[model samples]
Target: MPAWSSEMGAAMQVQIDKIFKEAAMQENIDDDAVFQEGDGVLAHLKFSFTLSDPGLKDCPLIGCSDGFSELTGYTMEEIIGRNCRFLVDPVPQEHVENSARMVAREFCIAVKDGEMYTVPDAHREPWMPIVHRDDGIFCIQTNARKDACLFKNLFHLKKIELDEKVYIVGLQTEMPIELWDEDQPEEKRQDACRAACRACHKNMGAAEQVMAKHFWFSSPMRRQEDGNDEDDGFV
Candidate 1:
């Protein structure tokens, strides 16, 4: 190869830099964890709280993230003050799809309705650690976006007490499609559906499933370990 002038080498380097910069920006658009925090939490992955409003009989959106708008194709103004249930698809919970699930759904509904549930005493299972789960809710539900596109939401509700105020924060993370794979082992699939929220809490890495693509308009999700990354209602 012939030796190149310093100017020629510099020109090539500039072009290479430009290409890399473009690629990085594209990846930022594709990945969800656009921002990271000093505390190691993904800012866009987790957002605001909701109160269990008795009079309204609904959990309204008290706050949210910009990532949610981008993913769902909705503007912040549209969702802010509305009930989060507006996005619930109803299909997954209603159409359990089999006899086993039909029975399970009844039990799940019961548990939801303040029945057949008791707090397990600490040390009952050495493998399981005791945690205050009374106020937190863990559920897997299908949700729809602005245009009626569907995706599974690993919905987690957290309880926070600040003096006299209690905040029930709704933390949503999109789940991977791998959970629905037909080739997945039967035992694994069954356990996913049958066990308590802990099954997915462990397997899917709770609060860390933010590595979701725009599932509706995109290819299969390549989630948190794969890469990584929310919102509210209006006036």
Candidate 2:
């Protein structure tokens, strides 16, 4: 019997809660946001759905949350048509392959639109699997605030259908150090966020990989990468 991520019912609920909470903390939302998922996270969930064009190379952001706006200091009109990764300043820690680490960093810092969004080349280790079912790409990525200050974000990317059109959604929250005094040193915040990223990632493995509520396509899902549009399926 093959398993799928859709079977993760209770876990889904927890993911939703965690996602909302993560977003709430970053922009300094009220405590009420802790339970209700903040103000703009849900409304701002749908991101760049431009995956329709095999010709278009980059994934653009269609919308974002108010908390996101607060955290990055970007207005809706300004960010509506840019690659989400433009905000990224990746801090590489999980290195399966040198290529994977480089790709992650390049996608975040170097590559232009559509360039970094592709899956790893067939010859390399597929370290960055886009876990479709569970919570998408749950990682601790550093993004530059509008003020040019670097901040850590609990980033998430998921693909969904809307009006028969497919779009990739992005959600981000500034995770805070739990139980640690705000007066604590900056290093502690890094430790807390790193731990949070690890725990979130750990939950997505195991049985959940079988369920793979992640994605399904009739003709294998292929994406355009660096050179000729070659791919080994899902990103």
**Deviation from native of the Cα of residue 4 in model 1, angstroms:** 58
TM per candidate? 0.43, 0.41
Error of 2 at 13 (Å): 19
- Candidate lDDT scores, in order, read 0.38, 0.40
Candidate 1: tens digits of C-alpha lDDT, residues 1-235: 1222233223333332333334334443222222223321222232221222212334444434454555455665676556655666344556322332223233334333544422334212222224454434455556677777676555445443222233344444554445567886655533433332332233222221221222111323322234422210110
Q: How many residue pairs clash in each candidate?
A: 14, 12
lDDT of 2 by residue, 121-144 (tens): 552322233443323444445567
Worst 10 residues of 1 by lDDT: 208-217
Give candidate 2's error at residue 60 in angstroms. 0.8
TM-score of 2: 0.41
